[model samples]
Target: MSRIAVFGAGSWGTAFSIVLADAGNEVTIWGRREAVCADINDHHENRDYLPDVKLPDTVSATHDPVVAVDGADAVIFAVPSQSFRENLVDWAPVLPEVPLVSLMKGVELGSLKRMSEVIAEVTGAGEERIAVVSGPNLSKEIANREPAASVVACADEDVAKRLQAMCHATAFRPYTSVDVLGCELGGAYKNVVALAVGMAVGLGFGDNTTASVITRGLAETARLATRLGADPLTLMGLAGLGDLVATCSSPLSRNRTFGEKLGQGQTTEEIYASTRQVAEGAKSCASLLALAEKNDVDAPIAEHVDAVVAGRSTARDMMQAFIDRDTKAERD
Candidate 1:
């Protein structure tokens, strides 16, 4: 059995640990909080994140990063995208020369790097040694052992296939891909689109509005991703369209929920005060927009989302801006 170390005790990390263990791998989770580590190890539950779901007996937890990664076959990082570099810098010394899997789905601010890129920069790992997992995954659903499919991507086909085997649980099916760029871009951009969808819901808009935003959001995501050297079909697959639909439609999505609050007139500061979980879109919109601009891609939806998040535009103003844009060919 493979020994997998997961560095994050949050909802997704804990949920993914279950997947690894269910697939007959030994999983060790490194949580920052001692209480969370104790609960996972002693009770087989992450009380703070997935309190209702029971974890596999093969799964355990530790507060120490060294303990988690010691003798591990692979290491998975499911931490917040904004703070990923900081966390990796501290943990890199203890990390083994094993495959690194990133479960994060947001672009890094300032550097405008994808999570895989950040991993390479921080750990000095080559493209073949890094992988990413993303799809229409919601932490609670996965933790409940619900059926789900995700893409496991790496530059090396062999590494991707190996990872696909490691997490191939009965309820969790994973497909392998060599298009790491496409997978990463699709995963990152969808969060910003989900924010837009959530704002529509919070504004009391019906399904029609949500549909328009979703369709257009997909187009925006495809434009940016393709411009940045990603395969367009990847955006059409599970990582892009599937992820967008789930995150935008599900009330469980943190980014969508955060945007809904913003549309309901709650300030960003107020929303941040109310939750411990990170809404990736709320934090990554600016960076994503910046990335699009750097590539000279037109991304009005992301631009509006960034403006609203920065307090420079109200949700209503964002809607109006979209409406006021000059008519053009749909493909343009």
Candidate 2:
């Protein structure tokens, strides 16, 4: 039995810990707030992020990073993408040289670094030992023991297999892969597409409009993935299309909710002001736009969302722009 350290106490992190513990591994979670630790230890619930979900008692929470990772067989880095680097810096001394897996899905601002790269930079860990988990995973559904499959990708195939073992339950299935880059990038890029779909939905577009977005969104995602030396099929798998569909359709997805608020005529600042939950896509949108431009890739939906969020263009204006694009062959 492995002792798994989940380095973030957010909804997904907490739910993942429960999955691991249910799989018979010992799991501990670390959160920045002392109350979060108390909530899990005393009440078995992350009332702030995951209310009404009763976590198993086997999962413990702690404020000390050392206590969190002490003698753990492996760790999952589930921290917010923005503060991932900082947390790793703090975790460097406390965490053992165990294999690490990331649950983050965003390109780092300015550097456009992937989460695995950030993991290595912050922890001084080897690249091959790092891994990523991505797919159609919604915290609430997974916590409810709904059937779901996630891709566990790492440079080391054996590490991926190990993670798959730890992540597996009757309801939670993990598929192993040796393409961490594709899996991680697919997870990161899909959020931008989800935001676009949400905006289209909020603008009163019917099923046909949103359906077209999903198909073309896959095409655009594949183009970028291939340019980055990722296998095209990986984008078509659990981490890419699977994840995109789930994120776009689910009301629980923070990225979609963030975009819906924008479509409802709220400014980015105002939307954020109204919610205490962290919607990752807000930060990921601009960074993804920057990456698309830097790589000379065309990502119109992503670019427009970035503009809306940055206050350079209103959502209504962007919707008009989308409509003005020249008609072409569906796949052209």
Candidate 3:
């Protein structure tokens, strides 16, 4: 059996640890808070994140990173995207040379680098050993043992396959892919699109509005992905369209939920105070917009979402802006 270290105790990290343990691997989770770690170790539940979900006996938690990372075959980093670099820097000395799995899905604010890139930069890990786990994974559903499929992407096909085997549970299906760039981009930007769809929902719009945003959002996502040398079809697969649909539709999606609040005239500060969780799109919108500018790609929906989240625009204003934009062909 493999030993896996999950370097965050957030919803996704906790849920994924259960997946690995249920797959017959030994899983250790490192949480920043001692109380959360205590809950996981003593009660087998992460009350702060996945409340009411019981973890497997093979899974454990620790506040010490050294204890969590010791002799692990793989290390999964599931912290917030903005804080990933700092946390990796602190944990780097104790990290073994194993497959670094990124559960983060936002571009670094100023650097505009993907989570894998940040991992390599901070930890000095090679591209072949860096992997990303992403798809339509809403933490609550996965924690309840609901059936879900995800893509494990890495530069090396062998590495991706190995990770796929390590986390392959009956309830959680994983597919391997070599298109790491496509997968990362799809995962990162889809949160922003979900915010847009959420705003539409909060505005009392119907299925027609949601469908339009989803289709057009995928188009914009593809435009940027292809520009970055990613395979266009990868954007059509699990990490892309699959992820976008799930995040946009599910009430469990933090990013979408945050946007819904914005649509209902609540401020970003208000939502932040209430949830006490980082809604990735609210934090990554600026960086995503910067990346689009750097790549000379147009991401109108993402731009509008960013403005709204930043308190520079309102949901109604964003919709009107879309209507007033210059007309173009469907594919264009």
Please give the CA lDDT of all the candidate structures.
Answer: 0.93, 0.86, 0.92
Ten contiguous residues with the weakest lDDT in model 2: 209-218
Candidate 1 residues lying further than 4 Å off, grouped into runs, are none
TM-scores, one per candidate: 0.99, 0.97, 0.99
Off by over 4 Å in 2: none
Q: Over the full model, what C-alpha lDDT does candidate 3 score relative to the true structure?
A: 0.92
Model 2 lDDT per residue over 241-277, tens place: 8998999889989888888888777888998888777
lDDT of 3 at 246: 97
Model 1 CA lDDT for position 88: 96
For candidate 1, lDDT tens digit of each residue in 64-148?
Answer: 9999998999999999999999999999999999999999999999999999999999999999999999999999999989999
For candidate 1, what is the TM-score? 0.99
Q: Which pairs clash (backbone N, Cα, C closer than 3 Å) in model 1?
A: none
2 against 3, candidate with superior lDDT: 3
What C-alpha lDDT, on a 0 to 100 scale, does residue 67 get in candidate 3?
A: 98
